[model samples]
Target: MKMVKLICVLATLLLPHLAQANPIRIKDLVEFDGVRSNDLVGYGLVVGLNGTGDGLRNSPFTEDILGNILERLGVNVTGEQFRPNNVAAVLVTGALPPFARTGSSLDVTVSAIGDASSLLGGTLIMTPLKAADGDIYAVAQGTIIAGGASAAGDGAAVIQGVPTAGVIPSGATIEREVAFDFSGLSTVRLALRTPDFTTAERIERAINAAFSRHVAVMLDAGTVELDIHATQMRSPAHALGRVENIMVEPERRARVVVDQRSGTIVMGEDVRISRVAVSQGNLTLRIQEAPLVSQPNPFAEGETVVVPRTDVDIIEEPGIGLAEVNGGTSLSEVVAGLNALGVAPRDMIDILKSIKASGALHAEFIVR
Candidate 1:
């Protein structure tokens, strides 16, 4: 009977610490479906350069493409030695945004694929950007706007950022649009990026409360099902438009993340320790080299001799009193507890690893 009373007292003492953690926002937890963009890529030419474009003799593709363009313009120079110095073959890439129309313009990124030195002061010609379906979706062309600088001396060169690539704002006109019918669906599903049952339930509740209708139903940890019939809306898009905007508290696991190279540590607010005693210290070994000279007996003719010797020493930091890290129920408390140890971020990572190994850290430890 005495042991049972002690257990109950301990549970009562720990309950308050466990209830201090707060939930995160739902927008940071889930991703909406069908709200994505497609990638479009094309090979293009950038001309009107100032002696910095590709060497026509070295790059056969550039020569062939330029020659073909001249031929199409009714210039009969087939037998003439054709060499120009103002063009570079580049690869253009851009994203085809959702709901883009035939005349919509998007920014395109042009990068030199050849051995060109730079793409400064160049104008990209009309290039057809294609999708994976072997169809052109956008046509890219404009003056390049590179955000970099380069300079060279006799023996050294300094460059900043990217010198061979640039982006043109609204440079590409959409030639075709994809056919994704969003309103024709009988049912819609929401897939949470980081799946959690609590979050899924909260999302369902938030959607139902916004419309005052139980249209959303939790299907699993990662997905929620919404019945179109229950929304009482005019269309599926109309129902999702209202449901996606509803906000709710999110759920996440306690995590302790550390970056070894950058010496950066990120811990979730829920990360905690369970009454663990910690002691961190470092041992340093140092050595010094010196040369010693010795002469045989002083008066008589003696050969002087020298020998090298090294002095070694070991140092161990003084012990800090055994400190107990109390269980942290919030992120701020967790950081305060860790900072109290007076250790650098690099050393703290090692200490965190040891704590995790001992099963005292109540969180997922991820080393990256």
Candidate 2:
């Protein structure tokens, strides 16, 4: 009882701070337009495996790619039949970060697309990475770092991690740059990660206060327009350096999120609930079969007979009385009322759902 009182006291003291939003840097709240990553993909091959490569008869693509590579290297094998267990076909993927320059290296992932057992100890051949526009942007070639291993015998096999997929750090070199001029822009638009009118207005106010002028304007709930000329700065880069560090409070709607698979329930501090009642109970059934065998005496010459017996039962455990929760205005009051029910997390999930259905819960209910 004393510990419960102490917790309640702590929660009551923390509600005031929770009622107001905390200050977050502008960089964390919004995303700058044209500052993002682009995905690049390519088809490639990996060699130097220890008999773990794809079979020629089953994977025709692997053999075809090998023949093409050999032909590119000035090897004459037009009519020659080659069978080797040291090659595999793979798909390579990587991300080209914004502002990436020519010759910059990026990490690439290689995943087997054929019937290969493993990619361990294999080296990727030169492959060209292409963007969505069908233009070559980078070239990848490096050793593979597989994440898992496996071992097999005649009858039994054991596998640990994934052996058919791996990553090559700094394997791809950028050849072309995405067309985006970051320095020549006169106005920079800030897109909110989570759109909210209160948060956008607060950001505008914070920026104008920092510059001591009306340099920032709230265009909408999700966009904030900043004028680079009003700051009298050298460039947008310099203006960003000064503005991105300023802290502004962000607002969020009252929400409750639940994960059914993991039995997790998360509620925002702004969530509220009206008066409600909840009850829970469980019923179980059981059945058992038993048989008895009988035999005549040795000299009686009578056949054996079996008798069957069965037992059945139904049980109903007594359930607690319906618990009542009064209307709450703050998060602490709501939590304290719910905690009084003495129910499991999953059980509470059902109760909360029922409450929401009856129009008691005033927050957004999300199930994942």
Candidate 3:
């Protein structure tokens, strides 16, 4: 009881600081228009696995690709029948960053697309990565660094992590540059990651204040348009470089996020609760069976008999009754009021749901 009171007192003392919003850089809050990464994917092959590669009988495409690669190298196996377990078919995926120049290096992910047991100690062959436009932009080739390991015996096997997927750092080389004229743009739009009217207004004001002029305009809850020519900068890149670093406070909505699988409850600082009453209890039902045997007295030529016996009980544990949770104006107060109910976090989720149903929880309740 004393500990709970102490916590409440501390929470009250820190309420003022908790209510203040910290300033965040504009770059972390929004993405620049026409500045994004493109996804590139390609079908490839991995070789040199230690007897863990796909069987050609099951993955015939692997054999076909292998034949094609060997044919390209002046070795024709068109009419030959061979099965090897040292290669696997794979899909290579990577992201091409915005403004990437020709000859730039990129990281790529390799995942097996066949019945290959593992890709350990495998080398990926040369593969051409293409974008959505069906144009090759990069070529990927590197030794695969598999993510996991596995060992097996005749009776049992042990495996850790994933042995069929891995990453190759700087494994791809960009062959073509994405055409984007950043310097020639007349305007740039900043799209907020989380749309909020108040945050957008604050960002617009912060950018305008940084230049001491009306250069930024809030077009919607999620978009802020900036006029590069108004800033008197040489190019849109210059204007963005200055505006992206400006600090502004963002407004967040009051929310309570709960994960049912993990029994986790996360409440935002702005969450509030009206005065309400709550009660919680648990009911346990138990059943047991015991079999009995009866023998004929003195073994007088009588057969033995078996009887079944069962016991069942229902128990209701004592629970908090009609506890009143006072209205809370701050996050700390709300937390304290909930804690006063003396219930577990999972039970609190149910109580919160009930409160929301009763229109007492003055915030959005999300359950996952």
Highest TM-score: give the candidate number.
3
All candidates' TM-scores?
0.82, 0.88, 0.92
Give the worst 10-residue stretch by lDDT in candidate 3.
1-10
Question: Each model's number of backbone clashes?
Answer: 1, 1, 0
lDDT of each: 0.81, 0.89, 0.92
**lDDT ranking, high to low:** 3, 2, 1
Best by the lDDT measure: 3
Tell me the TM-score of model 2: 0.88
Identify the superior model by TM-score, candidate 2 or candidate 3. Answer: 3
On residues 249-313, what C-alpha lDDT tens digit does candidate 2 reach at each position? 89989998888886777777789999988777767799999888999999898899998888899
**For model 1, how does the per-residue alpha-carbon lDDT over 1-368 read when each residue is reduced to its tens digit?**
23223323444566477566544544456655675689999998899988778887789898787777778789877878866777899999999998798999999999998777778889998899999988999999999998786777899988888879999999999989999887777688888988989889998888888778778889999988888778888998787777766667778688878889977776665678877889878888999999899889968887999989999999987644577788776655666666677666677788889899999898999988
**After superposing candidate 3, which stretches have Cα over 4 Å from the reference?**
1-17, 291-307
Ordered by TM-score, highest first, the candidates read 3, 2, 1
